[model samples]
Structures are given as structure tokens and as C-alpha cells.
Target: MKLNVLYFAWVRERIGVASETVETDAGSINELLDELSAREERYAIAFSDRSVLRCAIDQTLVPFETSLANATEVAFFPPMTGG
Candidate 1:
């Protein structure tokens, strides 16, 4: 399936991209991360610590196990801290 992957904050810096169109065979978010992590050093650095990352599938925050079958967008970002 095709997914719009979005990166935020430091994650975007490491990946060198804010968003991308990805064709994935991943069934879940975790699987998608694994695929991205294998793409390059940047992905490795960006996704190294999964605990520090937050995700949303099609605008709804979800766990990594969330299914990606019908998702149009997936966003990844660092945990937010209010000022």
C-alpha cells in the first residue's frame, strides 16, 4: 500500500525529509519502521530509539502495532513537552 510518512522535529532532521510517499508491504507500524530503518544510516539514527518516538495513523495517535492496511498518512515525531 502507499502511505504518506511524515517526520517531525529531530526525526525530520535525521531523515533529511519532512514527508515522503512510501510503498510498503508492512502490516503494522512496527513493520514499517523496520523497513525504514533498513533504508539507510539516516533512518537508523532517526528511529534508533522507538520509545522516544510518537506515531499517528491518519491523524489518530496509535501504538506501533496499529494496522497500516488502509492508512493514508502516518506521522512520526518525538514526544511533546509543553512549555
Candidate 2:
């Protein structure tokens, strides 16, 4: 499956990219994250702490266990806060 992956805030800085197209056989968001983290140290650092991260699948918020079937986009970012 081909997925458009987006990184935000510090995640982008850590990964050194804002977005990229990823091709993977990962069945779930966790699996996809694992695949990315295994690719290099930068990815590993970016995803090192999953607790503070939020994810959206096709612009809809989803859990880490969410299935990636037919999903075209996945975005990862830190929790949003407003003052």
C-alpha cells in the first residue's frame, strides 16, 4: 500500500522532512510506525515517544491500532494545546 505520511512540529525536525510517500505492507498504524522507525536513527528519534503523538488517517483522528486499508494519508504530530 502507498501512503502519504506527514510529520509536524518537532517530529518534522527530527525526521528532517515534512512529508513523503511511503510504500509498505503494514496493516496498522503501529506497524507502519515501526517500519518507519526501523529505517533510520532519525525516524527512530522522531517516533521514540508515541505517547505524546497524535495521528490522523485520511484527516480523521485514529488510534494507533487503526487499520491502514484504503488509507491514503497519515499524519503524526504532538498533542495540540490552546491558551
Q: In model 2, how many backbone clashes occur?
A: 0
Least well predicted 10-residue stretch by lDDT in candidate 2? 43-52
- Return model 1's CA RMSD, one decimal: 0.6
How do the predictions measure up, each by TM-score?
0.97, 0.98
Give a tens-digit lDDT track for model 2, residues 1-83. Answer: 89999999999999999999999999999999999999999999889899999999999999999999999999999999999
Clashes (N, CA, C under 3 Å) per candidate:
0, 0
What C-alpha lDDT do the candidate models reach, one value each? Answer: 0.96, 0.96
Each prediction's RMSD over C-alphas, in Å, is 0.6, 0.5
Segments of candidate 2 deviating more than 4 angstroms: none
Residue pairs with colliding backbones in model 1 are none
Give the per-residue lDDT of model 1 (tens digit) for 1-83.
99999999999999999999999999999999999999999999899999999999999999999999789999999998999
